[model samples]
Target: MSLHDTADDAEPRGPRGIQSIEVGGQLLLALAHHGRPLPLKDLAREAGMVPAKAHPYLVSFQKVGLVAQDAGSGHYGLGPLALQMGLIGLQQYDPLRLATPLIEELAEALGLTVALAMWGNRGPTIVRVAEAATPVHVTMRHGTVMSLRDTASGRLFAALLPPERLREALGAGLDELATDAPFQQALSEIRAGQPARAEGDAVPGIHALAVPVFDSLGRLVLGLTVVGPGAAIDLGPQGAVARRMQQAAQALSQQLGWRGSA
Candidate 1:
């Protein structure tokens, strides 16, 4: 079943009278829509509950590992149990299996390195890679952890992350980095759904273009990226690459029964 179906199957029907359960359900929805961890106040606001009333439900969720509290930031995110549940639900769709051939086709067509990445606790991890046949290529080994602030794929993934969680992941005081005009511009572009590129950031002489992949409910689940030698594929060609990658991602999402707008 798709994520939506799984959620529907798990949802309680006929309206139970328990206030706690209702609050918990609302909290879950807020987290899903936010696509990132939220602090107590923000989560309460999103759920339409006051912090005092929401605390008990959050505490219960934490105890059950349905939610996690960040040690450094004290924010709450879907915990290991929630992730396991999502994975269990996603396994029915087999995203990686569905995405393989699409990545291969993208690599062949563009003659560039193509990759699919999924977000993890730390950052986006390269779950799959299809290298170009060309002798000279950008090398991103499978299982590479992308920097949330740097590479093209990383920027797109980070853009989908919750602002608070993103700040935490980027460490404190991003304003220092904001002083750099290029860094600010890159971030602005990513937020605007435009592709981003950087030289010698992720890999030397490598340039990359990336697009976000959304699931059935319009939640970002992964990123599709193509990278190659700077001369072979520059920012000028990114639009073409992005179009193809978006098509492939949409197809893969459809195979996974995603019904959301791509």
Candidate 2:
């Protein structure tokens, strides 16, 4: 028999390595693929491992906060450290490079200013902005850090990004845009608005709409937004700008290897 062929005809085979470590990894993989926290038995069953065997690994993961356990329901979830790690990777992930062309196309096609916002060390920062041909004096630009409680892009981040990072941004004195009752009300509106969010004249006379792009991992990768003169912009659910922005966002999300919106 050729070396390419397996000794046992009943099952196809490949090279084998350490079994115990592979089994442990299955538990983690199960948790990740499930897309939600799991109890001990469910986690083990998903991994094809016994509960008793999985407990030891779970204990180790919990100690480092890679896996956090809820005291009430005894569920396990990816912890703060995991979210922090993912966010760190995002800074160097070059999502803008992948997203810019699509962004430019949308801007030119719609005659609107488009921008991509991502979580930066300080807060939600506009990393790139594509302007329309007949330019308007839009307030936002590249490297402009948005105010979480004020701007539409900022509010999007405040609504979705990890709470720990939000707290850090607030601590850095980026709270100048106060979250007063009215501001809180706007945030509520954004969350309640299904599909996407819109804020009329978020920046003085400029109107904007934003839609979040979530990755397959069920995380907010970025926000894609369009800005234009308030008089011409429409924020209605069935408006032209809002629908096009959402379509572009859907395409971009797929390009980022996202198959489903979380």
Candidate 3:
């Protein structure tokens, strides 16, 4: 089998210049997603490219150790080179390092669980968590995926997302937004209107308030959330928590080089 057969069918369309490079990159991405060895024919079909055209690029990628071939089956898979590069990039980011103290402080002040979450491919995933220092408290495990429509963190994330991206993330159309009035209102409220607290959206008994943190580019990178029993942090207390979370998020954003309008 060739490499094209096992790749994603979707292909990006564009004008002439840089098309080859784009296609090659897409092919590589498809291979990476599969995470399994594939023959050149399978890869070409998946990428919707001719085998003859893809052969040279595959050879080039192999030379740089970006892709490797199995000795027995001659099938291709991602090589260690890409993993090493990704690790190098990840090392430069220290969101958890910057967020841990903030989460601890929030948890202590609010007497609730606090978490730092970032958008991931699967959804918004918690990166750091601080459990309330109480006998019983709300708990959210680190690396857990949370819903984008319901959770406080998810709302904050959607608020930071570009309009088109947000729409894609939600998988909802504009018409649906009108029918789903509550979601539209929540999106507007969280994105630019104000900080938000959500109750009984994701799961019962849990209440959460989240604020957005932006990077130097004014891009939303993560969110800070305080979570507790619904009764403990009612609407009134939730507002207070939102205010504090906003301040913390702003401070962190400044630290990250965001200078956008407040």
- TM-score for each candidate, following the candidate numbering: 0.57, 0.58, 0.58
Per-model lDDT: 0.76, 0.76, 0.75
Cα lDDT of model 3 by residue, 22-92, tens digit: 87886798786676778989998888888888888888888998888899998988878976875575556
In the predicted model 1, the residue pairs found to clash are none
Clashes of each: 0, 0, 18
lDDT of 1 at 82: 88
lDDT (10s digit) by residue, model 1, range 1-262: 8999999999878855986687688988898777799999999999998999888898999999988889999998898998898777766776677777888888899998888988765677899998888834444677888876678877776666666665665656455655767776777877776665656687788778887776666667778888888887757534676667767777777556466544
Using TM-score as the yardstick, the better of models 1 and 3 is 3
Cα deviation of 185, candidate 2, in Å: 3.5
In candidate 3, what residue range of length 10 has the lowest lDDT sum?
169-178
lDDT, model 3, position 66: 88
User: What is candidate 1's CA lDDT for residue 185?
Assistant: 77
Clashing pairs in 2: none
